[model samples]
Target: MQRFTVTLVWVCFTLATFPAQAEELALTSTRTLAASCAACHGPNGNSLGSTPTLAALNQQYFIQRMQGFKDGSVSSTVMHHHAKGLTTEEVTAMAAYFAQQPRQTPQPLPHQSFLGAQ
Candidate 1:
């Protein structure tokens, strides 16, 4: 029937749009939580210099480290305190967000040579 076909199309359209909206909401939630780390970890987990980069770190490793920090198994001047503030679900979301980020390739250090004369 025409009505049945129209109903099926409407259902499919609604279902397709729901996932995109859900994904956007999840991303927003993750970003909101990750924003707290921006000062040290850089935007989206890419560190600038001296600080260790978190971008593209494996999800399991990130989760494990965060859990360790939260539990006092890992020692850091600030991370432990910060980690303790996040819930397990928030930690998982943070890990997933950072793991999805693209990592910057390390630039090779420049070499220098000195001689009195050549």
Candidate 2:
């Protein structure tokens, strides 16, 4: 009986020291939510077009824009529909996630001299 009690305590202690598996579920959820933005915003929010990039955007700005979209205070062509379904927690998570990504600055177009230029 003494040996069994010690073994049970050891097992419980080992399990408690290890990280919980629930972390993976949280990562999966964040990934799933971010994927929804890839179509227009580019993968991981590094947009390669006219759309504003979400990567490295200020957290407060991101939240404000998202909340605006959700509340219909921000005018957008499509974001309103997308933002409508997100919970506040999800928005914060997404903002933090995207803010960690590296932002890509768009390059300026090359200057072309007119045919009449000297």
Which residue pairs show backbone clashes in model 1? none
In order, candidate lDDTs are 0.86, 0.86
Give all TM-scores, in the order shown: 0.69, 0.73
Candidate 1: which stretches are off by over 4 Å? 1-20, 105-118
State the number of backbone clashes in model 2: 0
lDDT of 1 by residue, 70-105 (tens): 899888788898889889999899888888888876
* TM-score of model 1 (CA atoms): 0.69
Q: At residue 68, give the lDDT of candidate 1.
A: 91
Query: lDDT tens string, model 2, 11-108?
Result: 99878765555666777788788878978998779787899888889999999999999998999998898889889999998888888888766456
State in Å the error of residue 94, model 1. Answer: 1.1
